[model samples]
Target: MHKKDNNIDIANDRNENIPTERISTMFSFGMGDFIYEVFNGIFGAFFFLYWETEVKLDIWIVTLAYVIFAIWNSANDPLIGYLTDRPNRFWKKYGKRFPMVMIGTVPAILTLAAIFSPPFLDPVQGAWIYFAWILITTCSYELFFTLSSLNHYALYPEKFKTDRQRRRAGGIRMALALVGTAIGFIVPPLLIEYENRASYTNMVWIFVIFNLIFFLSLIPGHRESNYLKKRYMKEKEEQKEQISFWDSIRIVLRHKNFLVVILIFFLDSIIGVSLTASVQYVAKYVLEAEAETSIYILAGFILGALISLGPWLFFSEKINDNRRMLIIGVFLNTIFLLPFMFANDLFWLVIAAVLLGIGGGALRIGRNPVMADAIDEATLNSKRHLEGAFMGVYTFFNRFALIAQGIIFAVVHELTGFNANLPNQTELAKFGIRLHTALIPMILTLIGLIIFFRVYDLFPEKTAKIKQKLKELKL
Candidate 1:
């Protein structure tokens, strides 16, 4: 027997209740965030600087290389998602997402190491070589990164079915992410000096080791049950809907609510990268401080984010409105950015970091749940569990942040006449760093918040109905 509504199919052959996952399972899943943030935070914070300043590549060459990397990185994600979402031998044996995640893990870390291990060559003479190395290594890193992260993200909606569960898991993930980000930000400066290229390589090795050790936690989280596997296979057999790659992409693009989430996320990615990437410049030129000062500044931000997590989660749970929570987050973030832009001294800068952290914590708290809400609605509409494709497309847009940041930095530096070789940059250069870090991000975030407020109509009531529909459809 089957039920049909609005030309949609609902299976009656099998119905499985959503499992109540153990705290340990949640922790293991959350560990993936830690690993992801640790790598991402470091990369965002230092990768461009390493090439532009330390390697002495021409800014234009570095920018061009990143543009190429961005193109490959952003374009591959949706394809990866579509490819992996299909039924396969691995899906039947080891589980649907686990093998794919494992395949991507080691290679991703290796390539991340290779990014800092560029061949010793003259920056101007071997500019193309340097550009090629960056383009290849970074794109390679993102290839495996997309593979692992897309599956990890896909699992969230599948594994945690309830709003309460999503909130709990999301909170844990954000908390761990901040800790990983702290490690990424704090440890690099402790190990690296501006003049020493070898120190950067050493820092990469340390992160590589740390990430491998922590990746074990992901194993337990990725475990799939016989029931889940059977259900997945059964659905694949029953639906028999042949969704092509372009069709999948088309469906994802046409989802209005999903597009809103994707756009907001895209803007947020730029904000995050711009702020993180500028910290070293801020510490170096703006504050006229040693490399270690970067640690203190990052610490202030991390500590602020850490301390505010509890309150943000608490209030978000009370509100039970992911949309409202995200709105509040954006508003808070916009307000907090001004202090950092104006602060000249270490004390004031750290104070600003704290305020930014509070706002950041709020944003993190709401981001995933709202995203999950969007995913739930999409699944309900598509009548298929296409979380992988959805997440892939989301990441597809998200990776363009790299390209956007590349353009922003190139334009700003060129216009400001910022010279990386100088020990002390001009006042214009310092202002350029400030513009990317605070002012521009603030403006983009404000625009995103406004658009999100206007277009995102998946309010609590609507989301609840979507969930109910999904339940009825057994997706």
Candidate 2:
């Protein structure tokens, strides 16, 4: 899978325009995102049980309630993407992302507080409260999430001028993001053990407290990119002023290459969402590893985060190629998954986790830069202001992947009767959980290649043309 050269060298000869310090600060956005993911992913995994199992709502009501909250969250993703990019949006203004992010925090926290605050009534009354709180949190969370994420990603082109720079920056961001994600996933299960050995409310508080703290870090350090910098100047009178909002969006949707990214990324994301949602089930059932599985994922996340640094330091510096490296990583992920299908013991499962770590590490480092390269390529063709629209569309495509994943989970949960608080499920139910976790993710990794192969040679020269024009416009 590893090759000597990539399909494109979008910045092979460009001087390193992004300093290490700026990259470090720029990557701080990951800290915010990582916090969000940890809370969002973990809460999604366990909150239903917090309602039906611990809070003890009726199964029929809780099931439908969870579905209602889920659809509410999923439906808002595209809108979040679309609106976060609106240049004229003027409520609270640091820039496009920060305003949306700032505004979103209040609703998100309120919703979360409502979620954890137990309502006192019979099942019917409780269901309505649950629906209202969860749905609101879901909506606010989606807004907070997409806005922060799009703003974070938008910083890339503004701060970094070359492909290598983008990759290295991405590596740092993922490494930190993984650290936050690992802490989010690993700590709660181990640290917040129940006094009664079953009470989950304590754990929910633990999750919520950290989530709040995660956002606080951003308040002090989070600054928006300057849209009117000399470094960011545009040469063409048409390109100098940001393209009109509608025009900007039209450019993104019209690009065919961008479409391929959307297709493959969504497929890959469906697998991601399914595996993440099923992590608890797989750990408890298929691997039969219990708490060890969470530990296993944490270990994998840490290793993956660390491993990403090596490529930025070594291969990204030495080789002008990433396509082959990405392919190598994808297959590494594929190979790692193979072990899970055959793994009969925890020892072998650990090995599979490590391999996944390595594979995921490489993918994390390069993934965003590839998109950035694609965006650069699309801009050359469209010649309109497109970063926001691209970010918006990218958000839409990825969130839909999460939505697809939720569907997978819903189907698999029903299929397997994944009884959240039930003492034990049937052997057949456990097998279905295994299939959800293993086979589906493996399939998606293989399918990712199809989208990648369609890359139509986005070399550095192409980006240089855009950069040169941007420079001339500035002068």
Candidate 3:
């Protein structure tokens, strides 16, 4: 029998050595983001466009469906988090997160296909059907996504305990995430033509297959090491007193560092969703460009992000502070976004995409490491190791950004007198599209940067102290 160690391992206590196999495993795990990004890109960039343009649903109905879905999405996250974090016999056999992840894979794939495959009906009847399907599919998708992603993310701090390790792993992860974004945003434009249902359905199927492939690739990587398994088991044994679900909510809400992280992510989500949702509009209406033109713009963004990842990684390592790096990245991204409001041709748009991509690389790479630091601090402070709870609450607020995106688009289009029935929009409507694509995202990011600098207190020294405390607590 193995004896449980009360003292948790710290980076300083061990040699700075990672097994070669573990590195490979971690990189393979990064591919899982491909599935998530593809799905996210499709839903964020095209789902509303499809419903509003192809199916010709009223904007308010679409917004109302999303608002309801957002509520449901938020409520389910904490419940899943609370349940997953609790000690259970199943985790002893299959690991804590892998089972939930696997359980969600098939349903996530099926529902993704359903979202794009609503049956033929009149516009009014189809609107109700579309509304119902959106609610069902989005709620279902988020449920399993939360289950898998929360657990997958929870493992990061435990597995990569040192800053050096996190930077290496996180850099690769963000790179893969961008690749997924490319596949999600770039390829579909090539497959699906403007308002072509058959092509759209085909594209959906292709994404479904890709989702299955990448998510399945994560299984081997999702396995917990013997050391982690033992640590979790020990923590479970020692902490027999379970906190109530409401109490878990209260604790996470009260955490200043966690709140800062959520706020930044929340604002970022709004900006990201707005930009994505407006891409097709920008390509079609603003540039008066072909449907395929959006692919080039999105490709430019992805390529820039991929190319700049190395430099951002190095800069973050040099500064040794994720918060400052994020602030710098978001500020630069905001500057890049401004040019888009004035862009009328493909050349300038692609140029702006590249610059935005560079900023995005820094933002994406720094986000997780900082979030991991926050989770570590929360775990130590709470003394409960509730990664799921914290992630759940974080995800809950993040979904609100989706709700905001829907509302923003609906209101903007309505106010600007955008009619999907028209072959061409009025000048005001075109300006509204530009505003949604660039101006609004820039404004939101600026606000996020301000809050991060002023309110988020997880500086390098403070983070170091928190990690040191974790070591002292042996947690």
Best by lDDT: 1
Using TM-score as the yardstick, the better of models 1 and 3 is 1
Structure candidate 2, residue pairs in collision: 9-460, 10-459, 10-460, 234-473, 235-473
Q: 1-475 in candidate 1: lDDT tens per residue?
A: 5443322233442364456566677888888888888888779989888988899899999999899899899899999999988867556668788788888888888899899998899998999998889988998999998888889888888877789888999999998899889888888888899978888999998888888888887888777656567768887787666789898888788889899999888888888899899999898899888789988888988899899999999999899999999888877867788887789989999999998889889989999999999988888887778888999899889988889999999999999999989989999989999998889878887888889999999999999999888777777
lDDT of 3 by residue, 63-86 (tens): 899899888888888889888888
Residues 62-110 of candidate 2 have per-residue lDDT tens digits of: 5565555556555555455555544452412344455656666645654
Query: Candidate 1 regions off by >4 Å?
Result: 1-16
Model 1 has an lDDT value of 0.86
The lDDT per prediction is 0.86, 0.58, 0.81
Q: After superposition, how far is residue 391 of candidate 1 from its true place, in Å?
A: 0.8
How does residue 137 of candidate 1 score in lDDT? 93
User: Whose TM-score is greatest here?
Assistant: 1
Please provide the root mean square deviation of candidate 2 (C-alpha atoms, Å).
6.6
Better-scoring candidate (lDDT), 1 or 2: 1
When summed lDDT is taken over every stretch of 10 residues in candidate 1, the lowest stretch is 5-14
